[model samples]
Target: MRRKYNPYALPPWLKKSRDVLHQFAIPFCIFQGIRTILFPTAFDVLFLIALVLITVALKIELL
Candidate 1:
């Protein structure tokens, strides 16, 4: 029989905060994206960028 590989097993922290991000960040990004589209502005652009960067940092366990 073959065994399945697990990335989270290699590093326990890899799956850390997985639920939190899914429950909050993902949905927030969708709403924020819509708001930025309807009312485009410099602050909205910066906020979107910040959100994306923060999501990436959290995904890589940097923050």
Candidate 2:
């Protein structure tokens, strides 16, 4: 008889990270959805501001 391998198991670190990111993404998506409904035009502005801040932080750390 031959043994079978299973793919259901994942590495500890990957599973932890996946759970944490999933939790964070749910709230983030909800917030953005509400913002877009309230102020459709402002939603883009808010997203751009967040993108700029993230890029700035990355650049600062890289320098």
Candidate 3:
């Protein structure tokens, strides 16, 4: 008989960081949407940069 592996199981630190990023990303995305509606030009570039940085940071944590 062969054993199976579980992918959902993660280390404590990784789990915690993953949780934190998930939480942060949600609100940031909401605000970004609001910003897009409220003031599209003022922080257009800034918000794009912030989102990219957040994405890259999360990608590193995923690895």
Candidate 4:
């Protein structure tokens, strides 16, 4: 007998977080990609600073 595929076996929290991350990752990565191609050096520097600010905000929010 073949084993049945299971889609809902994942924990709800894990699934939710994964969905949120996936949503954020798409646009975030797209913008970063476009920024890199259109404005490599300047965008890279600004991206780094923005990333730092985002990390700090996340840390603060989590804490």
- Top candidate on TM-score is 1
Query: Residues 1-63, candidate 3, lDDT per residue (tens digit)?
Result: 985644367688877877788668757867786777778886775786677677666666542
What's the C-alpha lDDT at position 29 in model 4? Answer: 55
lDDT of 4 by residue, 9-57 (tens): 7688876875675446446756776777787797586885675555555
Clashing pairs in 3: none
Ranked by TM-score from best down, the candidates are: 1, 3, 4, 2
- Sorting all predicted structures by lDDT, with the top scorer first, yields 1, 3, 4, 2
Query: What does candidate 1's lDDT look like per residue over 23-60, in tens digits?
Result: 57767777889999999999998898888887777677
Whole-model alpha-carbon lDDT for candidate 4: 0.62
For residue 22, give model 3's deviation from the true position in Å: 1.4
Best by lDDT: 1
Worst lDDT 10-window in candidate 3: 54-63
Question: Model 2, residue 8: what's the lDDT?
Answer: 42
**lDDT of candidate 2 over 1-63, digit per residue (tens):** 995643246688866765565446545656766777777886566885665554454445321
The stretch of ten residues in a row with the least summed lDDT in candidate 2 is 54-63
Query: 62 in model 3: Cα distance from truth in Å?
Result: 9.2
The TM-score that candidate 3 achieves is: 0.44
Candidate 4 global TM-score: 0.44
Instruction: Tally clashing residue pairs in candidate 2.
Output: 0
